[model samples]
Target: MTDHNQAIRDDIAFMRSLAEAGRQAPLKGGSILMAAGLIYAACAFATWFAASYPVSPLFMPTLWFGGTGLFFVALFALRRRMGAKTETNRAAGLIWAGAGWALFVIVLSLMLMGYRANGWWIMAAICPIVLATYGAAWTVAGILTQAGWMRGVGFGAFAMALVCAWYGLEVRTLFLIYGVSLLGLVALPGYLAMRQAQRAAA
Candidate 1:
C-alpha cells in the first residue's frame, strides 16, 4: 500500500513538472507567419502596381497564386526547421492553422461569389476579412499564452481591418496599406516571437 501511494505521488509530480515546463516554454512557429507576411506583402504591392499600370490581366492572378505557392513552400521548410515541439507550440500552431484554413475557405467563397454575381467588387471585402481573421487568431494565442502583447496585436489587427475597409474605394491604395500593415503587424511580430522563443529555449 505504501509503495502504491508513493507511485501515485510520483506520477502527480511528473505531470506537474510537465505542466510547469510547458508554461515556461516560449511559443513556436513564428517563422511561418514571418514568411507569410513577407511573401503576401510583396504580392500585394505587385498587385497594386498591376492595377495601377496597364499590366496584363493575368498578372494579378498569377502574382497572388504564385505568392501563395511560395508561402506553402516556405511553410514546409519552416515546419521542418522548427525542431521538437512542446504542448504550447502545438496549441499555438493549431490556432494559426485553423485561422489559415478559415481564410482560405473565405477567399474561395468570395471568388465563387464574384464568379456567380459577375461582379468583382465583392472581392474587395477580402482585405478587412483577412485582418479580422488574424485578429481572432492573435487574440486566441494571447489568451492561451497569457501574453498581453499578443492581445495588443490582435487589437491592432482589428483596427487595421477598419482602416483597410475605409480605403476600400481606392483599390490601389488599399493594397499598399495592406502590404505595409502586414510588415508592421505580421512580420515584425513574427520576428519578435521567433526571437523570444529562441531566448526562452536558450
Candidate 2:
C-alpha cells in the first residue's frame, strides 16, 4: 500500500513538472508567421502581376507551390533551432500543422478536379476556407495560452475572410486582401506572441 501511494505521488509530480515546462515553453516565436506571411504575400503580388501582364498561367502554380515549400522549410528550420517541443508547443504545432495539411489537400483536390473551370469564384471560395483555418489556429493558440489578443486575431481573420469573399472575382483585389490579412492576422499577432514569450523567459 505504501509503495502504491508513493508511485502515485511520483506520477503526479512528473505530470506537474510537464505542465510547468509547457507553461514556460514559447510555442510560437513569430518565425512561422513571418515566413508564411511573406511567402503568401509574395505569391499574391506575383499572381496579381501575372494577371495584369501576359504571363503564362504556369507562373501562378509555380509561385504558389514554390513559396509554400519554402515556408515549410523555414518553419521546420525554426522549430529545430528553437527546440522547445513542450506539450503546449506540440499541441499548438499540431493544430496549425493539421490546418496546413487540410488546406493543401483541399487545394490539391480542387486543382485535380478542374475546379478552376468555375472561374474566379472557386479561387474566392478558397480564400474563405484558408482564412477560417487561420482563425481556428489562432483561436486554439489563444485558448491554450489564455491570451485574449490571440483570440481577437482569430476573430479578425474570420471577418477578413468574409470581406474577401464579398469582394470576389477580382484577381488584384483578392490578392491584396489576402496579403493584408496575412500581415494583420498572422504576422502582427505572431510578433506580439513572440515578444510575450521573450518576456516570460526573461
Residues 1-202, model 1: lDDT tens digits: 9999999999888656545555687678888888988998898888788776797767767887899999999999999999998766677788899999999999889989988999877888888999899998888777666678988999999999999999988889999999998888788888888998889878
Q: Could you say which candidate leads in lDDT?
A: 1
Evaluated with TM-score, which candidate comes out highest?
Answer: 1
| Model 2 C-alpha lDDT per residue in residues 85-160, reported as the tens digit of each score | 6676777778888998999998887676655575534655677788888999998777766567778989998998
Alpha-carbon TM-score of each model against the true structure: 0.87, 0.82
For model 1, state the Cα shift of residue 175 in Å: 0.7
Q: What are the lDDT figures for the candidates, one per model?
A: 0.85, 0.76
